[model samples]
Target: TIPACNANYLPEGISEHCPIKVTFVEEGLNTNKLFQFCNVWAKHPLFIDKVQAAWVKLLMVLLKKELKVLNTQFFRNVVAEANDDRMALYLAQNKLQADPMNMTLQRRREGEILEVQKYIIYGRDVLTT
Candidate 1:
């Protein structure tokens, strides 16, 4: 939960209004969820406090590790699946060359190649961070 106060100065005798309240709820523990939560909290004004900043940094580190593991697994799975399809296409392309219907398979293989390229770019961005 976060509390935001409207502290604009008024006349000499004006009274301040009650602070606004904001609440965040997390349904379960996951790297992405935790990372987003930490990111939001870290940007809050109160995060300038030393203790809060330290805790947020700690959470960021842990989330980074978790996300890295998840990304690695996802990349590996995509590569393996793409390789399998490529092998299958290699063996079948010649037999199906005369058949116009096989264009779909070729398109699928191209899509898989693009997916691999995207993953590689994403991995590099993550690592450089």
Candidate 2:
């Protein structure tokens, strides 16, 4: 979307309308290229302004279109499930500390600690070693 430094209209060959040729120069390099873009892009809210401001700094879109899907997956897989394991591990550690002989609390602590460790290994936002 760089600004065109030169423009010319060529004589119509087969079509009724003349073809517009635009030239762009960047840092001493010159180019004459034809750009083909999707019509849907023209419908964007900032279409006109984005084109005009391209010379200032070219910036574009990201995952803004489907953020809702990502939010659900991230919360369910990384945040909510990891928090559940953390809470269970915490309870198991406290109960085991009170009655060190209890086999049930010992087993629970082992299982929950493994689950929390899996989250840690996967690089999730959980308490680290």
Whole-model Cα lDDT per candidate?
Answer: 0.51, 0.66
Error of 2 at 59 (Å): 13
Against the true structure, candidate 1 reaches a TM-score of 0.26
| Candidate 2 local lDDT, residue 79 | 55
Question: Model 1 — which ten-residue stretch has the worst lDDT?
Answer: 9-18
Each model's backbone clash number: 0, 0
Look at candidate 2 and tell me the lDDT of residue 61.
Answer: 32
Model 2 steric clash pairs: none
Top TM-score: which candidate number? Answer: 2
Provide the global lDDT of candidate 1 against the true structure. 0.51
Estimate, for each residue in 1-129, the C-alpha lDDT of model 2 and write its tens digit.
Answer: 666477776533222355688786555656768998999999999999888888445333344335536756665535566767777776777687689899998788788878877866887555432
